[model samples]
Target chain A: MIAPLLQGFLDEFERLEAAMPGYEQAWLRQLRRDRLDAFVTSGLPGRREEAWKYTPLKGLEQRAFALPRGSALPPPLPPPLDAVRHRLVFVDGRFAPESSRLPADAEIEFLPLSEVFRNHDAAARFRIARLMGSGEDALDHLNAALATDGLLLRVPAGRSVREPVHLVYLGSKQSSGRAWHLRGLIELEGGARLRIVEHFYDGGEEAELSSVINEIQLAADAELELVRFQDMGARSILLSRTRLQVEARGRLRITAIDRGGELVRSEWLTTLRGREAHGDIAGVARLRGRQHADQVVEVRHLERDTSAEVRFRGVAEDQSRAVFTGTLHVAPGASGAETRLSSRNLLLSPQAEVDTRPVLEIHHDEVVAAHGATVGQLDPEALFYLRSRGFSETMARAILIGAFLEEISIRLPEPRFAEWVSSRMGLDHPLPWGGEKT
Target chain B: MLEIVDLHVSVGGTPILKGLDLRVPRGEVHAIMGPNGAGKSTLAYVLAGKEGYERTRGDIRWDGKDLLSLAPEQRAIAGIFLAFQYPVEIPGVNNAYFLRTAVNLKRKARGEPELDAVEFLRAARERLRLIGSDDGLLQRGLNEGFSGGEKKRNEILQMLMLEPELAILDETDSGLDIDALRLVASGVNALRSPERAFLVITHYQRLLEHIVPDRVHVLAEGRIVASGGPDLAQRLEREGYGWLAERRRASEALG
Candidate 1:
């Protein structure tokens, strides 16, 4: 009894299964078939499901999207970055080698997923098999069953990458009303350090649906900083999830800026698996018009002396709605684990909506956990103060909005990344403080 | 010159300023003293064009221009400034940036050339030095984590930078030490000019001792109950405002 909405995707997958990469490999074929069966059994999660209660898929299920094909010219990259040493470009979820600047260094191994499948790399196959074997839900299973291409990056032990590796996902409207799925994997060995910047943009004007899942694993003594900027077309829908695993003494920092897309659901699931592991997630979602953005985060501390912090800010204007849900869990016997989570949102209009929920579950007595969520409008006192200082009403509102999300910009590793986030959020005031002069 | 005649103000449908009248000519500093609930702050807020303080039946004229029709920012650009008793602490907004933006906005409104960051910084540093203060406050957030005295000084610093023609000090001496009081007074004294006027609102005569006023007016029952020279502030300090209501009743009975 598969739902008619997902029947289209199932049919499309069956039709293209034979041409998919690694189709001839028995194990890969079995993995895809099993995931497809899982997807069929559990269609799209409905409101009845606790995790999907705030998000409804009726708008996405109304229309069927065909697989994107044919190469279109990639749009010019954003300014403020004068040099990019290493970059991987994906057009419509398929790797575009022509637009990528692949690094030839010996300190790391970076390759497209299709290339890995073509070469029949044993280790790559094992990693992919393991990732697909542990599917969380319907969306994860669907991505596993259909994703054809993404990136695979691994940094060896004891090596620190000086420059950040840029990963660009461009949803081009060469052929309209299309859909694409991608899977990415990144691993840092013991004592390795790396920084990755991920950008999602729409190259043209058409409604496209995209889903991406990424797995990032940090070994002992490893550190990784990830910055993501998602600014796609106003009519596009995006579903993305990132799974993070950290070993002993490993640190992972994530800054996600989501200010685009008509309907977006972004999730991050992180697990501190070893002793003394640390992870922090900080992000901002600025939405206006009729856009809907949802950010869900879950962190699990499984070892002693682990710590996690999750801070998110949301600004919704017009008829837009923003939703944030954060959960922190400390496993039994995970003593001395500490966790803090907060979600603060600002509604700019009477019709705008914001919903936030922060949850904490500590099984160990020695564990420390705190969580808080607030949904409020801009401070009237702050606004009046700015107005009294000769700022126009609109200008005062903009300044207060900028200040509300200022902490996110300060946490950004690169100044250019901060500038990009500011521009997307329409915070381009003559800020006398940071960024270039207008 | 600034003038207010038969000014009646209400807040939430309750009258605060009932038939208040005041006039301050250019080149004169007038100190306004009052007890609590006498609408001393209300007058300040109304003059600065704050919202919610409705002008039910009143007319305020600033240099012969109607002032009630203007917005708060417009009134600021029109050369009126109010030093709030509680200066707002805006975290994440640098002090230098906020002041520079304010200075530039007023300048731009007057069709004057704008100052760049460097020029503004130099001017701000110079002012900071003249007020016997350090430049570190400029780099920090606008009054964030500042002490009570520091916050009062910040309000004075803004007044120095803005250089308003009619500067209204709304209890700026409420939460300051003796030294801070002198520092704030000096900052205001430096800007006193024949082309500018000061409307100093206070509850005590100590601030008046440093920034001496040409005239003193006692506001009671939302109206000027008494007006005299600088000696009036001293008499009130010694006698207190307990006699103000009785004195107002006596005057009304005589009328």
Candidate 2:
């Protein structure tokens, strides 16, 4: 029997397909059908799944979510970022054309993804397929069948975008009991450089759940710096999948910040397909209350001379739990590749839990790979050391935990941006002493 | 201004400090020189109120108040300081920020205003320069990846910044080079005042030559066996703990 949690999705899929625009192409329809069938067969991951054993989705088992509609012109909320220019806003799964803006020296292309699918003929379908990954999972199928609107960016060859692009997803009041599927397609041509900041925020109780799949492709010698900040409310659930492929000598760096959620799981996979490519991924999560967060990452080095560094830092307080797992694998041909993974977690409460695992699988003996994982509470010696210097117990613990998370925060490409993200989520408190909330 | 009377401390299941009694008056720097496992570190940990140390029988007073009743941080604000025998490496905590929080907390407890980051930085930078420390050292994690001498020096730097009335130096000169020992001892000497006191716990007499204590106490088997002037530390240096061990054996036999 199909799990009741996923049964409603089949009906929702039928409704979305009936209302969605531009299915004149039989190929796209077939692709969506296959994905839906795959989800029906495999179903949502259960407690028995080794990767999801610690975090269960019991709350989502009995809920039903429908797609929320968006407006062509929507009122603007206060911009979360101060220094960054050119932001593409999507509220309630629909791109807000009026709320979006582009730079004056805009040499790149930025268009609504729905518009691309609508205008592209059968011949142009190759681009769509390239952006759509294997499309193999429940959310992947859901995203394939029901994605409403997204931002499509194309940076030309040999040109670098100086200003960072902000992909802001806002959940509106009408989004209650609604789940949105968002897909972003980003392509950086050969030798091109671009930085994209993907931001996800639930306005309040109205927006409850969302699934996002972002596709990023870097060409030869191209460089892409992407940062993701998820600051959803405690009542919200968000699942995000970010996948990227780097060509020869291309560099891709992603820094993700998760500031608590009712349930949050982020899957990040990167493939280094060319020689001398570098992949650097770092994420930090600060969970409190009954919130839960999971970060799963996989890095594949398929070519020689590739290097990747992955690190995750997490803090769980109250009755919350945080899980982080990183896997690095080097193919036989990628003999000269080097990879390193580090996952560090701090559990602030006895009820809180953290699971960290770092795995390295190397098919080539010539490659250098190392991984380390640690899960522990605040060091008592460190705590006493701070207290001996007159820091109160709470202040001492905050300093140590915040500092532990700073390993990821300090390395953000934008320091002010990092601070903004932290302060908004109550994760970054620079004060030596703070209220009981910290 | 610090007094420890009939101090008894136990670690795990065994007693480490048994009936240790000592009085360090104001305007004096007392030296505690003992051999390995002589409870020198235990005494410091017990006085600082470190957890896991059970004090079954002890009374410690600082500045006419019951210091043992206070928490570790409370005792700190009450003008009691312990330069740890092995300073802990606090990963990710900023050194400068840590020192400032310490100074400001003590100040707040004493009914003084807390310094802002700018003011704290100015004050800390001045003290850091006075102690010949790299200004950038604070930018890194507190005592993380610090060299042996640097860690000891960092302890002294905190001591200098906090200016505790009664400071306990627990083997602060153990891993130091001759130069580091001189710098740390000088830092301590510079903080000496008629209204303040110090309890320097060390295993070597080389530190005494730098700070020149007012009195030296020899602790053997968890209790003070002898108390004398600086000449005692000089003798402990010339001749190791062999003489003290023999004296303790003879005293036990006579008893």
Candidate 3:
């Protein structure tokens, strides 16, 4: 029975391959073949694996998901960027080009993953091999086998892109029992700088599962800032996995803000491969109404003189649950490496729950690595102090909660993004500090 | 004007102030010098309505109203201020912010207009400089890292900012150096007016030299054992409270 299901997935994969008539990338063809083979052999991950303990894939067997139709293009692009830059909008795993906004920048290159595979063999092969790896996870295989449209980004050396690149994935309209497979690859050459924002939104009330994979490579002295915000509607299951590699003197900062979903899980894996590389990861999850948000991060310092910091804050209210697990590993001979991981949670309601686990694995003797986790409610004395100053009880509690999450929100480079997150957390009010409200 | 009639207080179910009686008319500064464990601090806390210090049998009237019936914040609006001996350190709460909120709370309660940030800053800066402190203290967390003398000076600064009608300096000069003591006393003196009354509680008579009092009382065993003029402080400083305790014991035995 499982073999036929696998075969059915392969038949759909073949249909998608035949539809792309002009694509001629040999390496991508080979990568797809290899991934399919791996999937046939490895099948799906079992519950015994430590990483898959909290999330299970048993629901996939209950129903078969249809391939997204590519007939309807996306709506009109948003703004001025619609002129120059290339755009690829995915709706339920199908490509929607009309809704994308592209800008005109010399060093900027954006294309569908199929085009990249057909034209740029070396880059396409590198990205595919890097993403697939040797792990035969069912989700990875399924994504490779069934992916309809993938977004590809490339930035040349010594060039900086001012306008932000946007990739938006919208689910099917009013469709239930469907699934989406999204694959994205971003490459930054030496001395290159890029800022990208990706948003995942859905308009349907159906039950759907989304498996997304993003791979980022930062060359020497390159700088990259990526912001990923997910606001999928209720009755949705999303699993997003991101892998990042930073070279010498390179910098990477990623911020993930999550809200509005029944069960959303995000995993971030980063490696500092060269000396003096820096990576900072920060995320905030606001949940309510029985929603569940899980964030798992793994940062490894593989060379000397590298540093990484991971900070996560979550606010759970109204029977919501949040889970955070951050692991920092320092390889041997990685001296002078400093890694700090902190996870703090605020529980606003009695029934709401938060689980935080911070782990540190240090093999180097001359490194500074520490991890801290805290989960609690607001302080009573602080609340009383604010209330005594004429602020209403509700406003006082909100201020205290906002102050607790301010440290993470302050790390966002853009004021608008910071304000968005603050407003989402209900912290845009004037706080009682320094005599005046802030 | 304030009156304390048969004020009795206890802490942890142990009586600290036993049938204490005192009265301060408007615009008068009365100094109460007491021996150790004379319930001096207890009296200050009871008047300020701090927790853990319960007034079992007492009637405190302020400005012709029952003061004991009000909460700490209400009393603050009614023009009562307590300059603590050991100022509490509230971390993460900026000093200026804390003071401004307190001042505004009292102002709003009295139907006065609230002061904006710029106006409050100007007024606070002038007051802080007048008390020999700088604006840097305003940026720091409220008394978190303050030295002993600095904490005492901050208490006086708060008293000055709040400007209550009935001010109680509870050993405000306890841990100050000579310069700080003089600065704090001068600040208190600057705030003294005919429309306000002051109750200065202290262990020694040294503070009296800077801010002279109209009357001095010696408290022993939770009650006023002797009352006299400024010379009484001098006499107690010389003779100590050993004789006063002896006389109190003998009088209790005779009764």
The interface root-mean-square deviation of each model, in the order shown, is 3.2, 5.8, 4.7
lDDT per residue for candidate 2 within A322-397, as digits (tens), equals 9898999999989889999999888888999898888788999899999998887888998898888787787777
- Per residue, candidate 1 scores C-alpha lDDT tens digits across A110-187 of 888877765656777788777666656988988888888888889999899988888899887787778898998899
Tens-digit per-residue lDDT, B74-138, candidate 1: 99999999999888888877788888889999999999998898888788777777667887878
Best by lDDT: 1
Interface RMSD of 1: 3.2
TM-score-based ranking: 1, 2, 3
Candidate 1 chain B weakest ten by summed lDDT:
B123-132
Docking quality class, candidate 3: incorrect
Task: Give the C-alpha miss distance for residue A103 in model 1, angstroms.
Answer: 3.0
Candidate 1, clashing residue pairs? none
Per-residue CA lDDT of model 3 for A70-114, tens digit only, reads 554443333322443434577776556656656554458777765
Question: Per-residue CA lDDT of candidate 2, range B1-255, in tens?
Answer: 788899988999799989999999999999998888989999898888889999889788886788878999988888889998888887666677677778888888889999887887777777666656767766766888998888888888888889988899999998888877877888898899998899999999989999999999998889998899999988888888899888878988999
* Model 2 steric clash pairs: none
How well does model 2 score by local distance difference test?
Answer: 0.81
Candidate 1's error at A364, in angstroms?
1.4
- Number of the candidate with higher DockQ, 1 or 2: 1
Q: Which residues of candidate 1, in runs, are more than 4 Å off? A: A1-5, A430-438
